[model samples]
Target: MKKQHIFQNALLTLLMLFGLAACQDREILTIENQSPAIVMDLSQEELFLDSNFPDNLALTIAWDVAKYSQPTELKYKVEASADESFEVPYVMGTVSGSQRVVSYTVGEMNKAAQTLGLTANEQGSLYFRVSSYIGEAGEYVTSTSNTTMLTITPYELEYPTFYLVGGATAAGWDAGQAIPLYKTSNMSYIYTYLTGNEPFRFLGQTNWNPLNYSIDQAGTRENYRYFKQVSSNLVQDGDENMKFTGTSGMYKISIDAATAVQSIEVEASPVAGWDFPEIYMVGSMNGWSATAPLTMAQVSPGIYEIVTPLGADAEFKFIGQKDWGDLEWGNILKDNHGYSGYVGPKGDNGNVKFVGNGGSYKVTVNLKAGTYTIVSQ
Candidate 1:
């Protein structure tokens, strides 16, 4: 009887094991061969961005819900291309499967337009689409959705160059000695000394003719200072010249030379004059050779610039002479010296730590502003 009971128990255990195996075989997950088409629609077909409304909503894109045979999460990447074939695409970002809409502000869309190489203040087509993926890496399926068109117009992000040439300025009407203003997208600025009773005007280049700028009238108001129109020594016919009537001192001159308007404003400056003949760059690039340092051309009174190849983590400093005996500048004077886009006048300041990949860079030093900038070319 005991043997019969043991045999029954053993048979029941074997049957339970087979049932578990069958359940495991049915739990397999299968991916469909083809991906469903993702449909996307835009809120606006044409986007005209305004700098004033940078934070305002520019556009919203909605897409159809992605479906799958089984409950699975989906990933989406927004791609933008200039052409339909998508030879090169600018990736916007990734989104979760549940997000069916994406929004772009005026600032964001404007940048996107610029990235697409759209001409400033001109209409251009920017093609956009989404790429959806299913499954994890090494085992995934990808699908591209229908293309959409956007007519975008971006604003100009840079301003034209301007030079100061006149009797009041140090250049003193000599086109070759004309001083260049530090230019930006919105305006051009210069901090220099000016004298009264002398007339001056702006030149597009070092020479005459072509592009010249002067006061619209004899005078314009700015607090206590005044730039009265000076009719004498006009480079071109009807090209009005202006003079500073205020007391002779250092002034901060800002120019707004847009296509629509030519404006100039003057104010007193607290900074001292920039007076340096020549500056040289001594760094790891030249094996820290002070005897044979790289020379930087003197662009303005105290401003110097140079274009040279820099390696990763390049360190350097500026000196008035090649041997670095006297005048020198490096990182700012602080307890822990580091990179801050500022240079100290003392020679003991820490080295200027370059934070970028190895490439050719345009190094600019503005002693008047007590700062420096490095831009990759």
Candidate 2:
């Protein structure tokens, strides 16, 4: 009787395992092979965001429920970009569940537009689309909606101000005449010029009442000093004075307020008395824009140098002045070394070609030798 009872128990367990397998097979067979198509209402008037409404207004976006044969937790996201191609769109908002709706405030819309490369205060058109995704990693599936149009104007954010002062600077001890630093894409400050023997510090304000920057060591360029506003009269110091120990030459000084870090690099200074006030590089990489050319540093009498990233098939020419004045420098002749192997202003004007795997390179141009070298890093 005990043996019969054991046999019954084994038979019951086998039936249960077979039932689970059947259910799994049914679920797999029900999964749809095709993705759902997003339904959008484009008949409504084009959406618009006012420049004055920085954060007051809200825009609602809705779509029809995506259909699926199998159960899935779908996540919907609204995206926008400057171009209709939606090559690199910015996610404005997201939603989940049957609601299928997302509301974006005026400020939020403006930020999205700006993130898509829209300029501030300028009216512009943008393309909007919705994307839905299910699962993660290996099993992930995605669907995109038809594009919609949006018009918006973004607002610019206030930028921080900085000035170079103290004895090491070109301005010397004159706080009122401290050298101003320019802003860059990374929100850091950059200034390239010749330096003297004295130590220097950066002031947050124009008058230097607070926010002074220095270095931990008197002579080192790295490990910068920072300060915090304690009170009306008190100030908290971070490090020592920032100074250059070696001989004076052209240098690029960059200060990052966000990370409280600083870097100093030796660069070529301007020729003592070159005819051209400024020299720049105009190339295919920069859209060949004569107005916004990359400036080169004059390290020696007739030699100019610039450290920048070069792309494959990059071609460039040197311009004597800001605008396309008459003077220009191009390739002299093809050399066995490689692209950009040799360059000069003589003979037929040819764009200097850069041939490499594409990376950061320090380019030095010597007009007298009619040659150029691309030092890949």
Predicted structure with the largest lDDT when compared to the true one: 1
lDDT (10s digit) by residue, model 2, range 76-104: 77787889898887777667777676777
State in Å the error of residue 104, model 2: 2.3
Using all chains and alpha carbons, the TM-scores for the candidates as numbered come to 0.41, 0.44
Residue-wise C-alpha lDDT for candidate 1, range 1-377, written one tens digit per residue: 99999999999999999999988876987645255546568899888888888889988887776566667678777777778888877776667758878888888777766666677799898888877776554136456788998888887754557778887776788988787776655466665667666778777788876766665542422221222322232222233566666556556676665433345777665433456777899998999999999999989877899999887779899888778675777875433255666555553357888866778999998776456789999
Clash totals for all candidate models = 1, 6
lDDT of 1 at 26: 68
- Which run of 10 residues does model 2 get worst, by summed lDDT? 228-237
Could you give me the TM-score of model 1 versus the true structure?
A: 0.41
Candidate 1 wrongly placed segments (more than 4 Å): 1-13, 23-27, 33-37, 134-141, 157-377
Against the unseen true structure, what C-alpha lDDT does each candidate score? 0.71, 0.60
